[model samples]
Target: MSEYRAGKAGINAEAQARINSKYNDEIAQETLEWIQKITGSPANTAGDAENLYEVLKDGTLLCHLVNKFQEGSVKKINQSTMAFKCMENINAFLEAVKKLGVPSQETFQTIDLWEKQNLYSVVVCLQSLGRKAGNFGLPSMGPKESERNVREFSEDQLKAGQNVISLQYGSNKGQQSGISFGNRRQI
Candidate 1:
């Protein structure tokens, strides 16, 4: 009897999971249709709708959605006097996040995700989130894209890099300290 009850519980959980998956797939299909309609682009039917969520939640997708909203501003459903509900939802979420004093990073990862994407209202978000940044261990100031430089290490630089790494970690590994080397690039 106990074994039967356990089996039934497992089946119930599996059934619920299937239902959720089906619901999400339906939503993704509807969203794809809306995206096509708004962007006036060819519809995408490449993969399972359920798989679209992973690709649709990035900075690139956010910018594309904003552009679609702008281009499709006049295309409205249900006796429209305003913008699309999708844009409204984003604004609403932004407002809610602002009121909670949450950092903009909580919504988007980097400042580029806002500035390069032209996501206005970031100033307000920064003001609100800045007040609570320290509590969350997040940096108060976001660096610009140009400042994020990727430098190719010279052969000498690589040796120096290894030395610096050795200084920090070699002590733990019972090794001698790193060889002293001068920096060629500014820290």
Candidate 2:
């Protein structure tokens, strides 16, 4: 007798299609071109999600790309085809990019690329890295990252802000609902 097994819980088809719809072929193509220019080699794949995944799933190119931004950022790039080895390379690339000023939130998890679960997220991470590349004096692919804008206030300004009540605390003007709470209805 065969034992019964349950299907894995994961994203539904509609949700997956929604995510896939958000993936822009143009952006992916540009990102691939940028990677090729930086790495000095062709990616040898079309910019679609499936092709991009096949090209980058191993993570070798990602490690190479990060190293171009910062010399020796990823100390060891795995060359094996083993699952864990590829994941290690992806993780290493993520860590190296994080050190190079790419925010952790902007980076993709290994499984996202490894399993092809969310290729759009991978493209987003690459685009973020490309934007961060501007800090290294390299040509950026997408929109440039915004610089930090910090403001300081004097002691008087701080005190004035504390004393003033902002209009955001909207005035109720004693308005009340006609209905009463915790009261029984008379038949």
Candidate 3:
């Protein structure tokens, strides 16, 4: 999900040229400004914005955002299941782009940059709000807030196979007579 850089000479020079020409440094600059506004963060007039935007335009931004958002937002290990759900959405986005047609380097790179700068921050905010105590442990990397799992199970199914032990071992409270009758032999 890293940024995109123009590779060797074999790439369709016309296409690359078109992307470079159409996007230009100005587009990167403007997109960076937009990212700052969206995220409510300081502007990156520094080269960081341009560099990130290039990657966004390449079609790798979804993956990068998913991974980072997953890492920065998840507070516990069990949250991984939730993180995976978020990753699925990112995958869907990538699939949609593929179905449409490959994006121009400029377009993809710009989008990637926006995710890294703005969308990512939003994920972080969401993660903070969603955090809760968990029986599972935390990861070494960090919390992630990509997406939540929409998968659900029926309440009846969840209750099945559970060992509901009563605390009153010796007490007759709520005891059924069937077991007592079975214990007594018939005359």
lDDT of 2 by residue, 77-123 (tens): 99999989999999999898889888888888998888776788899
lDDT per residue as tens, model 1, 89-128: 3444354454445555545323212212212223333334
Estimate TM-scores for all models: 0.25, 0.84, 0.27
Top candidate by TM-score? 2
TM-score, predicted candidate 1 vs. hidden true structure: 0.25
By descending lDDT, how would the candidates be arranged? 2, 1, 3
Which residue window of length 10 is worst by lDDT in model 3?
132-141
The clash count of every prediction, one per candidate, is 0, 0, 19
lDDT of 1: 0.39
Model 1: residues with Cα > 4 Å off, grouped in runs: 1-19, 22-24, 40-43, 46-50, 70-187
For residues 1-187, write the lDDT of model 3, one tens digit per residue: 2347544365665654544443334434443443343334333433343464343333233433322323432222221334345444444434443333323231222232333433332222222322311111322121443456697889887687365655654777766666664497455
Best by lDDT: 2
